[model samples]
Target: MTSRPRTLIAVLVLVGITVSLQQTFVIPLLPHLPTLLHTTPANASWAVTATLIAGAVSIPIVGRLADLWGKRRILLACLAFLIAGSAMTALSASLGWFVAGRALQGIAAGVVSLGISLLRDHLAPHRLASATSVMSTSLGVGASLGIPLSAFLAQYADWRLLFWTAGGLAALAGVLVLLVVPGRSRPPGGRFDPLGALMFSSALVCLFLAVSKGGTWGWTGGVTLGLFAGAAALLVLFGAWELRTAQPLIDLRVSRRPQVLLTNAASLVFGFSMLISSLVFTQLLQMPTAAGYGFSESMFVAGLLQAPGGVCMIAMSPVSAMITVRFGPRAALMAGASVVVCGYGFAALLHTELWQLLVCSALVGSGIGLAYGAMPSLIMSAVPVNQTAAANSLNNLCRSLGTTTASAVTGLLLATMSTTVSGHVVPSRTAFTTVLLTAASAALLALVIAAFIPRRRPATTAGPLLATPTAVQRHEPRPTP
Candidate 1:
């Protein structure tokens, strides 16, 4: 690979990891936030919820804007949000300021999707496959690494240092982009749809709010039902408006394509499957061993156990790319999803051994690396080059939807089926087992979904990928003897 592609991939991957640091970095700090921020536990939980809502709203919007404005330009804006948000969170003493900062940090989640689109705008075809896989898996890498790092920080150092470190890294990423990332000209496109954006944002907030808060707020409560109804009504309106508009925020027509639609569906299922580890494994490791299945480990040690899974994710990126190159992205998706199915299957049956669970987690992480790497490649192959960011962001939104749904379902299951150990209620072994089995089912569904994605059509337009005819010829697949 050329120095430019190598450097660009490194920079974008760094940005991906930096944004994902917020994913689980706050989990260890959550229980203490009530005392630290001088708020009730219920209100303190908003520090987490705010980020979820903001990320759901910001992700697709950022992608659309990047397609309309410029990838590098909007990317800088995202980095700015990260820096400012992290600094705000680090300095905050009150609950309100802290939640606001977290929301900004959530907006930065769009960076990963944006980076994938930016990669398509540069790099050669053969190189794009591996580079994209590495970039897509970087989120897992960061999230995996962040948990232990955050746990250690929360355990020993001041809590504010987490945000400060995140901010410093984001600032460094921004500087690197300024120096290394080549700027793309803003392609001629239709006007930005303000009304469409507002409607879509409102609808998303309603949907996500109901999903995230329903467990705490009461599933059958009037407010939860109201939010769901509101989301449905607004989406109907948003769809109509997008179809009527000259340049819609999301191109509904393209989205209806089987390739796009199926890949997104698979993404949702795969995302749901992936989050099971975060929700179930962490609790399983940290819960009191008296609960029968728990290990009674500290948060830091629990995090250390999961960190190897992140390493596995990074390790599998090249393998994922190789699969995509050899047997199309569809096969790659199915192959990855099947591996995850086995991972969860193993966990469901074997809970007594720590090493067994660690191996299972690593297996799931590797499968996720393989599957996630293929999603962008699949989406980009089917969509127009100009809409790469928007499409990928939409797919990301699907994954977010999956993760959000996973959190609610798993939370409900764990909460509903519980037993008391030493007078304190905890999720029962049956409930824990059910969650793992559910994740396995979701992975199997993803495999079934991937089976339906039409084979990747040969690249019609390499766009910015083709440096010259000679470079294109050099990158073409060689015939096997």
Candidate 2:
């Protein structure tokens, strides 16, 4: 591989990591937000919710914009939002300001999808699989590593320093991208679909708000039900509009291809499967030993235990790429999902020791690394070159939807299935077992879905050159097998 591709991949992966950091780093600070900002707990929770809603809204918009404009340009714009938002939060004293800042930070969520698209545009066919694998794995790597790092910082340093650190990292990433990443040549020409973007964002916000807050506000309460109703109505309208629009924000026709549709379906299930381990193990490790099946570990220790999974994810990236190269991405995805099912199966049976949890978490992470890596390759192959960013963004959005659903479902399970221990209610062993089984079932479903992805034709010759107007006009050199 050339040094330029290596440098480009490293920079993009770093940007991906920074974006993931923003997703989880604030989690450790949630409990302290109410006191620090002098607000009610209910209000403080918006710090998290705002980010989630903003991210969902921005992903497709940014992806479409990246395809229309330049990916590198859109990437830099996202980092600027990250830097500015982090700075606002760092300096804020009021809850409103913090939530606003968090919402701004959320806009950076499209970086991973954009990075994958960029790789498709630039890399040679032989190098694309591995480069995209490492890029995708960076998401899990950042999420797992950020938890312990943020916990340590929140414990020892001022909480605002976390945002300050995030800001610094975003700034650094922006500068590196500016220096190393090459700009795209044939930027797709299309008018921005404002109506579609508006409808989509509005519907998503309602859907996400209802899902994320249904437990807190009674699930059947008028507000929650109203939000759900509104989301459904808007989504129907949005779908109709997208179908009619000349230059749609998301190309519905392309997205409906069997490969794209099934890959996205698998992504959602895989996402749920991935999040269950994080939700289950963290609580399992922290419960008091008096609760029969508890480890009573500190938050830091629990996070540290999960760190090995991140390592396994990074280690598996190359293997995933190899699998994608040898067997098509369809086989690699099924293999990954099968591995996840095995991981969850192990967790369901073995809950006695710390080492067992570590092993289980690592197993799940390895599967996720492989599955996540394959998704982009599957989506990109099915869509036209210009639609790569938007398609990947939609896939990423599906995963987010899956994770949100997991949070709601698991929260309800743990809340209802608990035992009392010295005035505190803790999740019972049965509850934990049920969650593991549910996660395993989700992975099994993903495996079934992966089985249906269309098989690729045998390679008779080298793959096509990078898709660009210049390359189209004058035949570019294909990579030698």
Candidate 3:
């Protein structure tokens, strides 16, 4: 296979770094957040939730903007938010200030989804597959490095420095993305859907706030119930509005395609399994030494153990692309989801040993890498080129929704079922076991959806991927079979 253009390759790597760094950058400070801000643990959770919620709300908006205006322009706009937000966070003296900074960091998530959409537009088809895989896999890379690096810095220095570093990184990426990437075909003429944006944003915040704070709010309390009701009603209104608007924020018809529908359903399952199982590992590792199956590893060691999974993901991405090509995206997706089920099954049975946890998690990571790599390809195939950014962003929103569900459900389980063993009220073996079962169930659900993916066999004869081919060399030239 011929190499991809150097500029194209550099842009992918930088975007990957930019996206990954945002999520993991705050891991090291999680433990100290409450004390640092002089707030309750429940209130401190908003620092994390703010960023995730922002990403969930902003993704579709920024994505649609990228499709309408230009991908590069939207990406630069996102980076500007990241730089400004991170710098503000570094200077903040209170919890409210920190949360503001974190909310801005959500814009970085737009960079990730939009960057992936642009890959389909600019890169040759063969090159696009692997490039997509690498960029998607960067989620794992950013997460893995961000945790350990943040821990080391937080342990030795002030946590505020973490945001300072992130700000600098964002500025550098903005320069690179602007200078290196090619411009789009042309800007489409359309105004931003302000009403849809408002409705969607309000709905997302209410739902996420309820889920994030439910642990402390008492599940049946007035606050939780009110938020849930408000979110549900707003989302219903948002859907109705989108359906009636002359120019809808999201094109609902495109989402009705079988390939797009199934890929998104599978993405939700993937998100649930990946986050829940990994968080389970964190709880298991941080358990007291007295627990026969537990260890008291520092935050650094915990991050270190998880690091290999990202490595495994990076190593497996090319293989994932090859599988997508040979057996079509449907079969490859089933294969990936099935593998993830096996990973969760092993976790349930093998938590007695550290080596078992690592091995099982590596299997899970491999499955996630493969499945995530295929999601964008599936979406692009189903939607028009003009809708690539919007469709991909919606797909990402499903993953986020799944993750939010996992976090809330697991937190509820652990909080309600706890046992005091030697004056420390840790989640009992029963609770942890229940979490494992729930994670396994999520994988099984994904596997079932993956099974229904419709087949779209490629044409037997080789031809150019697009109607008019560019000058860049494609990676997979037709075999001389």
lDDT of 3 by residue, 22-84 (tens): 777786577798889898877788888999899888988988888889988888888899999
- Of 2 and 3, the candidate ahead on lDDT is 2
Give per-residue CA lDDT, model 2, range 219-256, as digits (tens).
99999999999999998998898888778899787788
Q: Write the per-residue lDDT of candidate 1 for residues 168-274, one digit (tens) a residue.
A: 99999999999988886555455788899999999999999999889989989999999999999999999999888877899887788788899999999898888
Ranking by TM-score: 1, 2, 3
**Count of backbone collisions within predicted model 1:** 0
- List the RMSD of every prediction in angstroms: 5.3, 4.4, 5.6
Q: Which candidate, 2 or 3, would have the higher TM-score against the true structure?
A: 2
Order of the predicted models by lDDT, top scorer first: 1, 2, 3
Residue pairs of candidate 1 with colliding backbone atoms: none
Query: How many pairs of residues collide in model 3?
Result: 0
Backbone Cα, N, C clashes tallied per candidate: 0, 0, 0
Displacement of residue 148 (Cα, Å) in model 3 is 1.6
TM-score of candidate 1 to 2 decimals: 0.94
